[model samples]
Target: MESDKMIKPTVSYHLFLYREELARRNARQLRLSRTKIDITEELISRTVKNIKTCSMDDLKAVNRELVFKRKLRNRVSKLRKEAKLAKQ
Candidate 1:
């Protein structure tokens, strides 16, 4: 009878701790999910704002400028590499 009483309280204490841990984990997961949702919403809003601000032609012109700059940058780097090889 004494052992049974001790065992029952011990089991109950462990069960309580387990439940508390599970609740904490669940709360943390819920918080993280909420944060993810907020970030995604912000990104979508920013993308929509950008699309609204720029006309199609403006966007195309900007893209073309970026492509031309990239090509020029690549050419410069290639020239630098060739000069380095010639030195060696």
Candidate 2:
């Protein structure tokens, strides 16, 4: 009867330890999940900012090229008129 009583207490103690360990594991997992979400949000913000900056740079480059081409076309037309007058 004494041994049976001791067995119950021992089993309860082991169960308590198991519960504590599971709680710690769950807390650790929660922390890791939170960190992953934070990092992902930061990365997304940075990527969006980079894309906006790159798009602005691309627009500026295209505008500059268009202006340069227009000036080149005007110069070519003037030169062609001069050549025609010379031939006459």
Candidate 3:
């Protein structure tokens, strides 16, 4: 009887679970949306050309942008992991 009581989930408990699932899905979607840059071959070629032809200051700016994107990716990955663990 005690086990049965513990095993049965209430309406509020169901709602909480639904909310948690929604939050997880939202986090996953946010990560996808934020990182969805279409890096085609043309873009890569353009970047290579820019690197070869750009001034030192332009190269530095590009380096900074790359670093910023790296950090953002890391942060998003961390957040996604945290969200995954939280679901458990």
Candidate 4:
């Protein structure tokens, strides 16, 4: 009986935390959405096109952008999965 009582509170706490996390994620997703996904791809493509021509700073900047692009893609995919889970 004690275990059953503990389970309910734990489950409620889990859901509460999940909801709060999702809310923060959704907000970030909104900001990320401002830029089209393709923009990153295009930027990478352009960077590659100018690879031999780019200065060290340009290359470093592009590298940083590439890292951000991966992070953005991962976050978007995660948000999609969470949305699907919420539907169920």
Question: In order, how many clashes per candidate?
Answer: 0, 0, 0, 0
- Which structure among the candidates has the greatest TM-score? 4
**What's the TM for model 4?**
0.59
Q: lDDT value for candidate 1?
A: 0.52
Residue pairs of candidate 4 with colliding backbone atoms: none
Better of 2 and 3 by TM-score: 3
lDDT of each: 0.52, 0.51, 0.55, 0.66
Where model 3 places Cα greater than 4 Å from the true spot, the runs are: 1-29, 36-45
Candidate 4, residues 1-88, lDDT tens digits: the string is: 8886665434335455545656783545534432434456657777899899999998988888888888877778888888789899
lDDT per residue as tens, model 2, 1-88:
9887665434335455445655784543333333333343434444556665667665565456556555555665666677689799
Q: Judge candidate 2 at residue 82 and give its lDDT.
A: 75
lDDT of 2: 0.51
Provide the RMSD of all predictions against the true structure, rounded to 1 decimal: 23.7, 33.1, 18.0, 17.5
Better of 1 and 2 by TM-score: 2
Per-residue alpha-carbon lDDT of model 3 for 7-36, expressed as tens digits? 855445545554565678354544342333
- In terms of lDDT, which candidate is strongest? 4
Clashes of 3: 0
Greater lDDT among 2 and 3 belongs to: 3
Q: Which lDDT tens digits does candidate 1 get at residues 33-78? A: 3333334343444445687687887567556655655555566566
Ranking by lDDT: 4, 3, 1, 2
Among all windows of ten consecutive residues in candidate 3, which has the lowest summed lDDT? 33-42
